[model samples]
Target: MIFEDMDRIVFAGDSVTDMGSAQPVGEGLFENLGTGYVRIIDNLLAACYPERKIRVTNSGISGNTSRDLLARFQRDVVDLKPDWVSICIGINDVWRQFDSPAIPDEQVMPEEYEQNVEQMILQVKGKVKGIFLLSPYYMEPNREDAMRSRMDEYVAVCARLAQKHGCIFVDFQQMYEDYCKIRHSTFIAWDRVHPNRVGATLMARAFLEKCEFDYNHGNGEVH
Candidate 1:
């Protein structure tokens, strides 16, 4: 029922989305979306509702920022003509500043990040059945000053875009922070940018929580 028999799901974003697929650029069918959130969603759905037969694709590229996403939106995302699309970006918009000194923070300011996300949303509006937004996150179980200050702006822009465009929003920032209380940020992320398998699984699960599955209508419980 969710697919009307042939629904296609596509994920668009950065390295977190790009777990470890063959084409790091996210190409082909099975290997297209890498093995991150997209593949996880595929496995869960296949297990929960085998009859639904949802098709998933990943177009995530490693080391990408919102700006980079916007540049490849047409080729990597829109052209796929997916039934559902989820956008997860903006981390690099903040992380690069900490890792790469030559890169200026202004290049990915909250304002600019907002504009890029807005543009991508506009491109996918009406073209896909649903659009999901995932906020960029940083975990400081210790609540480090630098991490909080930088991620604050990036998270805000993601929230603003989700509100303005009426897209399903996943708070990776909040989720990571919550998880940090139980485990060190380094355990989930090495340099605090790229997520290890555990972190990626966490993100994938969070995204599915926001999906409106048709099977939920009978239980009156959100899917």
Candidate 2:
């Protein structure tokens, strides 16, 4: 119950966070929240804490990097005046380095990525009650994998910033790494990026854990 009753949380990130969420801003009824972890989070909050009535907004955009998110941070995040903001970017920032190695301009280096994320934290930390920094992940299980290894660097950056800013940090890379021990990455995502429903649920669970979500507590009863 880190979040107070009626507190609004805005989730900002790339396609993993977007997952086909409504355009511009995703909130309200129907499938506006998309089918990703964001939606799963909304469902869990409603089911587990109906009385809290938290407002969840999705501000994720497909193929966006840290640079892109920072560009729209004001309009998409700050303007919303949310009580909490959860950022889950950096995947494409690392992906572009591999998928489009030839396009040097398309890639965001680690230094710049760190700066962008840090800048975001600085901008919103004072405006919100709490901030959640979700590390970007590469679903590959092997630590020796080039992409996975490089992604680890970004994950460390997020962890470092989270600690410095006193924000809640969710290590999604580690989460997937642990899950891969029991189930292969392909079982959840074919490309190891965009997750299917199963993978999304795993992410939702991890996020809820950080929020101190109680699945068994409901209607004045703790199951």
Candidate 3:
């Protein structure tokens, strides 16, 4: 596994990462990690690698853009001193351009979004064991669609940063695009943003794949 025993992973992002996770920081007991992929990852880690006591924390806030996350990155993410930091922002940065077009200042342009994400990465690069950069995705499979096309630009930015920083990159946009090829976007997310349980599971699986998670690690062992 990419993560060592007792390593702590903090997931920081927007609503998709939030999904009812505790305010500020969420971890330990109950649904503090929210009902999203963060929780799923925690569940699977504990289930399959029972001996590895990896800590999972969620610092996601709904309706936040990259700009917002950057503002609180230090307090919410850095101060915690997690072994691994997973950033899943940029969705709202693109969403505002379409949903609230009238509020020009509210929108986080691609350039600004890239700067914000890069700054966050720089803050934790040498301080952590590893980082996970999860791209912001629009569920629309049609590449030509205005929103999806705009979103692709952000994904490219994430890919670029992840490579430059030597971070583990999870291309969620491409993952959903592949899934949408066989199943409609509505099957997972109706608005094509907030994912249902199935979509969250798919995301968890994709993330674990990058982490070298062994689903069969506990196989043939008596519980």
Candidate 4:
């Protein structure tokens, strides 16, 4: 696995990452990690690499855009001092532009979104061992859809920054697009944004793949 023993990984994003995680910080026992992909990643890490003793933290906040995430980056991410950081934001940035067209201030344009994410990466890239840039996705499979098209723009920005900064780019938008081909977007999320358990698992699988997680390691062994 890419993560070293006792590596502390912090996941920062919006509601998709939050998914009801404990306030301020989410970690430790009793499901404080929430029921999202973050918790799934933690569970799999423990089950597959019992000796690694990886520490996982969820710093996601609901309804947060890249702007909001940047505002709290220092307190939620930097001060926490994580070894690995996974950022999944920008959904609300695109959503707000379409959902509330009248409110210009509420909308975070593509240029600002790109800058906000880049600034966050610049702030933490040197401090953390590595960073994972998970693109903000709109679940609609139709590329022609206005929201999905706009979301693709943000996804491109994430890819560009990930490459420039040497961060791992997890193309979540493409992941959902592939899944939506077999199953309708509504099947995973009615709004095609906040995923249910199944969609969350898909995300977890994708993340673990990038980490080179070995599923067969402890498959037949009983702890």
Top model by TM-score, which number?
3
Give one digit per residue, the lDDT tens place, for model 2 in 46-92. 88877787999999999999999999999999999999999999999
Q: Quote the lDDT for 199 in model 3.
A: 96
Model 3 agreement with the true structure over 64-141: per-residue lDDT tens digits: 999999999999999999999999999999999999999989899989998999999999999999999999999999
lDDT of each: 0.77, 0.94, 0.95, 0.93
- Model 4 is weakest, by summed lDDT over 10 consecutive residues, at 214-223
Clashing pairs in 2: none
In candidate 1, what are the lDDT values of residues 1-223, reduced to their tens digit? 3443478777888888877765534544665557666676777676666655677777788888899999999888888888888899988888777778686853587778888999999998988888889888877644457867778778888888889889989998889889888888889877776777688788878877776544344353324
TM-score of every candidate relative to the true structure = 0.87, 0.97, 0.98, 0.97
Task: Return the number of clashes found in candidate 2.
Answer: 0
Q: How should the candidates be ordered by TM-score, best one leading?
A: 3, 2, 4, 1
Tens digit of lDDT per residue, candidate 4, span 12-109?
A: 99999999999878999987999999999999998888878899999999999999999999999999999999999999999999989999898999
Off by over 4 Å in 2: 219-223
| lDDT of model 3, residue 81 | 93
Q: In model 4, which regions exceed 4 Å deviation? A: 218-223
* Alpha-carbon RMSD, each predicted model: 3.8, 1.6, 1.1, 1.4
The most accurate candidate by lDDT is: 3
